[model samples]
Target: MNADDAAADQLPLIDQEDRLMASLVPLAGCRLVEVGCGPARLLRQLLQQVDGLECAALEVDRVQLARNRSEPVCPGLHFIEASAAAMPLPDGWADGVLMLKSLHHVPLDELDTALDEVARVLRPGGWFYVSEPIYAGALNALIRLFNDEGVVRAAAQAALDRALARGRFTAVSEHRFAQAVAYPDFDSFEQRMMRPSFADHRLTPELIAAVRQRFEPHCGPQGARFVRPMHVRLLRRR
Candidate 1:
């Protein structure tokens, strides 16, 4: 990882203006949209740090959308429930778009359509920031025992590359970093990951035993600590 990559590894946890990628993102007084925004955690952080940020949080999961709607927030924030392949927003709707750790979650068949939607929603010269988890590392090894995402993740990267070649967007920058994933124990890992809001994971006995066997070696007095590799692509709307 380069200096910027190292700094961005702590992107979500702390408010490091320099490391938060404020320079690459749209400046103040711009509207932003986040596809698959989930709980709007990153949107909340960006709104607090960036000046005059109007964000549209989009999610395909109605459950997550409803949960976010119940929470109170400023009027500048809006929530929309929609799939990435078919966003409800109008053309040229936003100055910037974000898909953090969410693009790969889009259905594999619709990945290209989702990228097209991203390009459609962004105005000329607008920015799109996409961050995806690299399918490797100790944590991933444990998870692959039951739910493997190698194929989908590879397809997601291919879609991004194809977008660049299609001439709708220009790849301005790319960065790779690592984020720390700490679990108090195996139970915490299972609860948080296996039952994630988007997908259901069935952990058969054999799968459970495999995960336990692989995860046990990493367990320490405090817990298990693993670093997940991350790849980020910053594209400018052409």
Candidate 2:
């Protein structure tokens, strides 16, 4: 698995992507939509895994969404530039929905709306898969040097819990795991995770230096390795 996956914390999210897709049996030709699909990478993976599955992706970052849309279409793949709280998809349009480590990125005030939107799109008995990065871990410690996600992460979970309380969907599964994010060197990590264009984490020169100082301690002969905690919630629309 690459360092870009958001679902991996204790278990390898990429390695188990196929397993997760296959677990949704009898869905060979089902329609699925992913909210907050960064670059639509998971969508591509699912398309490859589930033959004849119609897939759609929604991304708040227009840059990433544009790039993803420009990629050669894979028959049933579609990409849209929109936020989770305000997707353009029609109600009851999807058989399932996936959110991979992205709910926290939604604006705090709009989180519940986004969950409502997920329910709106999913047909009754459809599934909603949510994977989020937990707040405690070596990776979180290091990344907090530049961008701290504590508040948003907690907010995301609270939103998920509140959604569950409404009883519109029934919880089917809950999982937790950790995964290793390997960087050949500090440069790679800086480029990929530190100043990623998708987020608003702007690093100043001083902050960059601070991050370097914090990150250097973890670097070794094989480069830096970080263990990130992840959590997944599988729910079914009732």
Candidate 3:
């Protein structure tokens, strides 16, 4: 399916962002803030579930912010165009903070300051949750092929560890979740792989094509399948 068709069919629901929001439903009554909320997909869902709850999303990309603004926003959902390191909200203003599929994009040098901002915005006893990809062994190879391996991997884990040591949060939980992606044919698989998000990496188009060709036969009747493993960490402010 083309990108537009896939989007229309809600195929995007299979991504990590959707899963993270589903996981956070238990924290329904709390006021929530999401950093790096690309397109505010999860933010919209959260607004739908929690009645009278306030939710704010901080997105750095002006283009994305403009698109989100053009969409019909829920009364409880608010969007702010800003960096994660400097949110406009007051300190300790949120009952929960979420960073999903976004920590990896943060620069390593500025990560500490960003985490501090997250901590500052979260209320005492509030929850801070982050879900990101961890590069382990072969996974590092795959990620490096597409993007900055060392920086993305290290920054994600560093943010987690640093948040754990902040003393403001307790009972930190770290776990991994996996999602499956299935492609119906080589054409579809190729299209998905070549998306701007994945293509900018170091992996050459030829290499990706070769890998896809070699693996296509083993993909079961579903055409092609790959497991995307995600790391999730949850912490409650003390």
Please report the candidate that would top TM-score against the real structure.
2
lDDT (tens digit, per residue) of candidate 3 on 1-238: 3453233333223454555655654555678898988877777766766566788989887767788789975788888987878889998999988888788777777788888888899888788888775454232333344454566667678666767787656755766655555678766755555443312445577877666666566467767655555667888877
Worst 10 residues of 1 by lDDT: 9-18
Score each candidate by Cα lDDT.
Answer: 0.82, 0.81, 0.69
C-alpha lDDT (0 to 100) for residue 210 of candidate 3: 62
C-alpha RMSD of each candidate structure in angstroms: 4.1, 4.3, 7.3
lDDT of 1 by residue, 1-238 (tens): 3554354445344223225568666558888998998888877877777789899999988888889999997568999988899998889989999898899899988988999999999999999999888776666767877789999899999999999999879999987667777899989988887777778787688877778888888999999987777778899999
**Against the hidden reference, what TM-scores do the models get?**
0.88, 0.89, 0.75
Global CA lDDT computed for model 2: 0.81
User: Mind giving the per-residue lDDT tens digits that candidate 2 earns over 1-238?
Assistant: 3353444444644445546546743467889998888877777777777778898888878778778877887778888778898879888899889888898999999999999999999999899988888877668877888888999999998998899999868898887776567898878988988877687677898988888888888889999988777787888888
Query: Positional deviation of 35 in candidate 1, in angstroms?
Result: 0.7
Off by over 4 Å in 1: 1-18
Better of 2 and 3 by TM-score: 2
Q: Return whichever of 1 and 3 wins on lDDT.
A: 1
The model with the greatest lDDT is: 1
